[model samples]
Target chain A: MLRVKNLTVDHGAIRALHGVSISIEKGQLAAVIGANGAGKTTLLRTLSGLNKATDGSATWGDLNVLHSKPESLVRHGISHVSEGKSVIPELTVSENLDLGALWRRNRKESAQSKNEVVELFPRLGERLSQRADSLSGGERQMLAIGRSMMSKPQLLLLDEPSLGLAPLVVEQIFQSIRDLTNSLGLTVILVEQNAIGALKIADIGIVLNLGSIAATGSAAALRDDPAVRAAYLGF
Target chain B: MFEFVNTLLIGITAGSIYSLMAIAIVLVWRSTRVVNFAAGGIALASTFVGSTILEITGSFWIALPVAMLAGAALSAFIEYFFLRPLLKRSGDKNQEIFLPIIATLGILGIMKAVLHFIYGEKIGVLSPPLSDKGFIVSGESIALSPLRLLILGIVLLLMIALTLIFQRTNIGLSLRAASFAPEISRLSGIRVDLVRTVGWAISGAAGATAGILQTVNGSGAVTPEAFEFSLLLVFGFVAAVIGGIESLVGAVVGGLTLGIILAIILMYLGSSLVFFAAFLILILVLLLRPNGIIGVKGGRRA
Candidate 1:
């Protein structure tokens, strides 16, 4: 289980995340939905050790997630896939995947992880030898998620995985995110601007507005909330 | 015809050394986004170590590797204790590059001053390991010699080894990934700071090789303020820029191109025209391509 309390993050003088708090259970999928600049990415980045929190405490089990380095967090079974197509463009898909498991010493387990990633995203399997720059945006997103999976993290933090991707591709990626939680029993904190799609697949949804959590409930309840639908979901 | 062939051979030998120096510059640039002007100082200091080793062991073979190791240590130290903090404080903006370059120049000055303080009035001799006498071809003595051949062979081998490391090894992959996307690499569990240090170490080794070779290839002597070392720095930087300052292959091409053309100019025109010719060639290429010969269009700045 992962717990964050009273998390406040500042970008220089302006506060990005103001006293935000959320909890996620192991194997549960939590979606953080918000409009642009509502601290969606900031929240995720803080948890992943990319952003420093001005005042907050986050813990994954007994480990202090706030103080640990990003690389240390990966070893402790937390992986972050940042916004945009994050794979190294010059490296081949195979090489990028190998880099994800670079710290993993067991060759057999690493190979197994690679096979699992390939199975999850078959397009990546076909383009293993191709440089990532040649990959389409959708394929690059798939590679990003696949590369994160290579670390075999217990908790995965994904920021806007469906951004700019086609509807069909976005649907496919969302389904994979759902499958990761279901099949692998991995906890996920997915930040997205596509509230409806994210809410549909999420078990729990947190609606963020103006850097504060406006609502948090079961995904179904949030989907049924009239205010959330009008304001964020745009129903 | 014989004179032309001899000039070509001489140019190639000199070019190969410049390629190693250019490679050193490229490696540091790619990893840290800093144009390391201190590379020449690192090379000079390491070559001095080689000279000492040669004096002790009486073997050029032993001196060379020891100098490389010393170079690697010094380069890594600078990256860790100096460049890392400076970069962190300044941030990664492209416009902010000048400060780091200036910082490196300061380091270069300090290194030279320290060398002068330590080895003042003492010259380090680095005579050729093998015979410098030109190999006899037909009825003539060609410019190619055992020492020249050895230099070419070593450069080729290092290039091959570097290629294999980048292609086949995990460490090399991390180095590439860290340079390309440091944040992403860190998220992927790579220690980017450590990888940057490794890149500097490799660059140091290459620079040390260039320094030792330049010394032996010329007057076989080194001082704290050697004109030959200054020439190496200038030509190497020009070679890297001409090759686009990004790719290792581009460095080799740039080095060879600069070397051959300069040699030809020296032979046919005059020694005084060589520097002017280098600048003219660089201007011509930049006007034509804007990027070095093998540099990609709109490549990643970091």
Candidate 2:
């Protein structure tokens, strides 16, 4: 389980995340939907240790994740895929995936994990040697997710996976995320502006109006809610 | 024809040493977005250590490794103590690099002063370990000396070793990742700071080798105010710029090209025009390819 309580963060002088809290169960997909400047990305950054939490605490198992370094979070099986298409531009698709597995010392286990990642995003298998800059936006996102998965993490913190991607590509990528969560017991806290598509596959939905959560419920309930739909779902 | 061949041979040897130095400069730049003017100072210091070791032990074998270790240590210390804090203070997204560049210049000056303080008016020799007597080429005894051959061999071995390390190792993968994307790399469990330090240390070793080779290849003497040592840094930087300053292979190519051309100029033109010619070549290459000969807009840089 991954938990955040009263977590706060600042991007420069702006309070991007203000005392927000959320909980994600094992093997569950939690979609965090918000308008621009709603602190969705800040929440993930704080959880992943990229941004420090000024107040409150976050936990993944026994780790006090609020002040931990980013690398420590990965060691505890919590991998974070940052905002946008996050593949290393200079590294090949395969090398980017290999970087995710850098901390893994076991050669056989690393190789097996790599195989699983390629299988999950098989398009990556065909373009293994291509530079990540050559990857289309959607494929780059898949490559990002696949690279993060190379660590075989139990909890994955993903920021805006569907941003700048075609609907068809989004569908394929989200399907893979859903499948991974369902099959491998992987947990995901996906931050996205595309609420409807993300909520479709997510088990729980958390809506942020500004810096704090305005609503949290089952995905269907949030999807059906009039206010959330009018504001976020665009339906 | 024999004179031309000799000049080319000498050029190749000198270019090989510059390639090592250029590689050092490129490594430092790729790891930290700082152009280290201090690399040459570190090289001079390492060469001094080698000279001392030679005097003490009377063996080039022990002296070389010791100098490399000294270089690595000094570079790591500079990265940790000086560059890290300096970078942190000015490393905001819109961080201007002029301050860092100036800071490195100050470091180079300070290091040179310190070396002068320690070894005032003293001259130390880095006598070649191998015979410097050139093998006879058509009975003319051309410029391909055995010691020059040794320098070439060591440089080739290091380059090949570096290639293998960068391409075939986990640490290498982490180093590449860290340099490419520190945030993503950190999230992927790479200690980017430590990797940067390692990168500097490796550069230090390269600089040390270049220093030792260049000294022995020339007057075989190192002094606190050695003009050749300062020139090594300048030429190395020039070579790096020519190669596009972002690629190791480019650095090697640039170094060799610079060496060959400089040799040709010294022979055909004049010795005084060597530095002027280097500046010209750098300007011409930069004008033609702003990125460099092997420089690409994106990809693994070093």
Q: TM-score, each model?
A: 0.98, 0.97
lDDT of 2 by residue, A27-92 (tens): 889999999999888888888888887788888878889888999889989899999888998889
Q: Give the Cα error of residue B229 in candidate 2, in Å.
A: 0.5
TM-score of chain A of each: 0.98, 0.97
Q: What is the interface RMSD of candidate 1, in Å?
A: 2.4
Clash pairs, candidate 2, are A90-B299, A90-B300
C-alpha lDDT of candidate 1 relative to the true structure: 0.92
**lDDT at B183, model 1:** 97
For every candidate, C-alpha RMSD to the true structure in Å: 1.4, 1.6
In terms of DockQ, which candidate is strongest? 2
C-alpha DockQ of every model: 0.71, 0.79
lDDT of 1 by residue, B18-41 (tens): 999999999999999899999999
Error of 1 at B248 (Å): 1.0
What is the i-RMS of every prediction? 2.4, 1.4
Local error of candidate 2 at residue B8 (angstroms): 1.4
Candidate 2 lDDT for residue B188: 87
